[model samples]
Target: MSKYIPGNQKHLTLVDRIYIENELNRGTTFKDIAKFLCKDPTTISKEVKAHRLSDWYHKGTFYNAKNFCIHRYHCKKTNACGKIILCGVKCTSCPTCNQTCRDFEKERCSRLDKAPYVCNGCPKKINHCTIAHKYSYNARFSNRKYRELLSDSRSGVNLTKHELHKKDRIISPLIEQGQSPYQIVTNHPELELSVRTVYTYLDQGLFTARNVDLKRKVKFKPRKCHKTQISDRTVFINRTYQDFQTLHLESFTEMDTVHSSRDSKKTLLTFFFTKEKLFLAFLMNRCTEGAVRLIFDRLEKRLGTYGFISTFEHILTDRGTEFGDPEALETGANGIQRTSIYYCDPMRSGQKGGLEQAHTMLRMVLPKGTRFEFLTQWDVNLIVNHINSMPRESLGGRTPYSVALETLGEEVLNAFQLRPIAPDEVNLTPKLIRFNS
Candidate 1:
């Protein structure tokens, strides 16, 4: 990119600067360089003169390189300090000579007065030219400064505080009252802002309503795409959501996994009962089909076969890869059917939305991207106890623990070791679980 074709773009690009630097080193005249770039010769001259930087590498190699006296060559004085006899060291080469010399004249570069101002085309090395100070132009440095100035050249906010406040007043209250950005913009035409813009305003902290207030938006990602090949597609045949709807079971549990981070292998398997609204989680070394099946086997052993069948008569979960093999979970080792397994439709996590909402409680303690490698099953149980004990308006001001105790029986609750946390002591913040320990 020696030169760009002449166009309406006025600003000098990085390529133009590089070309100018190379041309100056080859002693190319400013007029010829400007002719190739389709810019005025004076524009090129001003650019080089304004952005040249001083070369100061000598300070590291030579300790006494601070000498900037114009008469350093002819006037040779010794013992710049107050001494009767000469100290036998030339003042021109002394470290403190510049400070003591009363007639110290600052050196200036006369060559900078000519057409090409920078030292990029200088024939002498930097060490020889340091006496009078040398300056060079670099393409990367000049381009970076030009971009900073270009950004600053633009003006401040187009809207005033009053105007912004007016929009915020209309948008924030409705958003906090459970309305989406799309709904606000469509319902109130006076906003004159796009849904995406409203979301941006929220992100920038320009409004009172935050991203957390929009519960559904912050709880789940917009997309969950899995492009892996299905080794066995026949596993989803009769166990589809359609087949489960025919049974019309009065109560069921939704199953899902919570990832601590994408890169970490450790994960948590969660179970949310639809009727009792009780949440339970088990930490695993990794999220795998075999791990999930093993957890089911452990749960059956802990609850007894008959108790497990009564508690989990029918289970509905998403089509996650870890939940791929359902037969291992449904059939016990003694060849008895414990519980039926069903899968939600593809891309439909909302089918078991009761569990999806419960995931938020988990995220409050362990946000996305948190490392779960150090956590234990006891830590998971502690988190579940606090979550199930919190009072909810949907449950008529009663906690999930109280409901589970009566509905699922006290013996099952005792086996699970579920307890109630005081209403005032219910801490849902990230401080509840310390990952550092």
Candidate 2:
């Protein structure tokens, strides 16, 4: 036998069961076997009783002669046998005799009724015993049964239909009202369903609403490639993306132009602060170099030379024709360097990726193919304000407006007309802009 270690109360292994079977076959007592195995005597006793198999004959008679006699209560001569008067003659255990004994009756072993429930480790000879009752342990059978039970236990949800329906009632309405699962759980304290579970249920069509109804579930078209327009007369020679990286500057702004399918000439010039995630939008009459220059000049006049230089110390943009006039963008009204402008490599708009990602939020409110011809600078400002007010996970749940207010101060937010909206009221849908109009 292996040495027993204390405090090792884990589930039995096949090796342990094999050892137990060997001890039983050797006629070892349950207590002695348990002591050697470092398990309680009752655990050994229960293990035998729970796993032991039984064989039954016709009319539910156990195959054992003792059990068979115990089930023969309908036998005819009740008091004729002399043995009946003395002790008991439940049955004629003779194999030649037919089952015609008048006082036949079965008996149960008293030892099995107490402890060590099975016949395992019995000292009696099997051939001498009339009772066919036997107990033996098989390691392979026990291990297979254990694995099957474990798998069955881990297979299903424990929620009742009533509980699931209750959760669905609370969640379905919020989803249909255009609230994201994340927003619903965050806003409602009583909802017990997790955001992931809600999404899973939505995907499974368990809810009344589908994923297509969700605002953010809409698909966007892939970005098209624009041909690179390299020019010798352009001022990009000194202000390449390589030049921008060499400066090791902490703060810079990414600029891009957003066009509408309804009007070719009207567009929105957008600027994003990479570090703070602050975004500003200016409505332009056309997607032209002169229109972009006019917006920059107006911002310089509004912020003054010092404020403009401090805020827009470096501007990184793609090689759009509207931003092709890098010289005009770099020079102030006094013919001096207002701020440096750097151009990304041809066909690599991802070089200014911050603005590209920020544009997704803008596109949520003003989707592509929407007419921007009727929109004004104030209307664009309103849309940008709401976009900036949304909490970003990357910002530790702080809105861009909040971060900019702290980093760039109230003066900058006032200059851009950016204002913070209540967290719950920060809408990112076209309905908001339409309602404002």
Candidate 3:
């Protein structure tokens, strides 16, 4: 039993033979074996487990060295299973002779192949027997329907670097600069990007919107008016002077009737001087001759007779009822006696370009459709002063007051002033009653 293996005797290493016998026959504990051999118990255990021979009565008998060595030799030579059956070599037999379980219906290896009844060695049974199951747990069998989506190439098909840069660099900046998405795409068709893609890129933070400070404010849609009902005002001055290049500083005020609300019947008369960039507002019960006259008189009073006569050269107006009697007010107001008046054409509100332009500044305080009833004369005056003090691009960024004083010459403008013209003072009385004959 001890001298069974030739290597152990011919090479009869005292250490190997004694170590094995002490470990197997003497039933030395692993700790003792480790202490005796000065080797790890794990190494010794692995060696014994590998060499041990199995028998029905003796469970993996290693006590008989010769039987153990002989069984090892037979196993190597015969390709035999260690667990033998009562009848023959196999303890469990497959229907197939190739040592593979077969599905008689599919006529294939039942464990490795999908068959009508047999599943991969898994007793729970699955629809398909995957190759990965035999070797590793990570493998899975995906049906064809789901394979295309899970593939690598199609994951980012919808986005690319070019698209990202265009969004960040081109589309976003242009939009920020006041260009719309449609404009961006239309302007550069070769960019190969859609308007929707530009939007998508913006959302993803690939590009930022450009900051645009618009020179002219946005215009809102005007109230619907029947074409036939509009006034037949003259637009010669506006059409003749399309823009500021052809405009003059004389009076040239933009006029509109400010209202209490969209539905308010009460309104105020407003005048925005284009050259001076001044806002002159007065409350008006209606856009009638009386209201217009009162506004003109108030303006003259504040501006002075000389300043009023010099500055009130032209009044640009829309054909609203309040401004319809512009000639009478221009003549009636003592200070504005020398002023001429102009009108915007029928339904062409934009033709009175001067005041229409200044409306942006005026709206800062007295906004469009603002009710005259709610605002006091003092509030209107404050708003007017604020606007007159504001710097305007038309006057080289100078305020209306600054530009007016510069144009009119300070001393002369100050000397020419508004005064209370009493009705008695307005008389044609002989300046000294020289009719003593």
- Residues 24-47 of candidate 3 have per-residue lDDT tens digits of 433355556544555555544543
Worst lDDT 10-window in candidate 2? 55-64
lDDT of 1 by residue, 1-437 (tens): 32353641487899999999999888899999988888878779888988777775445433457777877777678876676384877888886777888888877665566878777777764445654467788988889988888888774445679988999999999987899899999999987888988887888888888999996878877565575323477988998899989988768999998888777899899999998899999888878999998888888888999999999889998877888888888998788999998988877889899999999988998888989987888878888998998988888999999999889998898778677888888877777777425
The alpha-carbon deviation from the true structure for residue 84 of candidate 1, after best TM-score superposition, in angstroms, is 91
Off by over 4 Å in 2: 1-230
lDDT (Cα atoms) of all candidates against the true structure = 0.83, 0.76, 0.49
In model 1, what is the error at residue 384, expressed in angstroms? 0.7
All candidates' TM-scores?
A: 0.49, 0.48, 0.36
Q: What is the TM-score (0 to 1) of candidate 1? A: 0.49
Q: lDDT by residue for model 2 over 267-305, one digit each (tens)?
A: 999999988999999999888889999999999888888
Task: Predict model 3's lDDT versus the native.
Answer: 0.49
Candidate 3 residue 174 C-alpha distance from true site, Å: 46
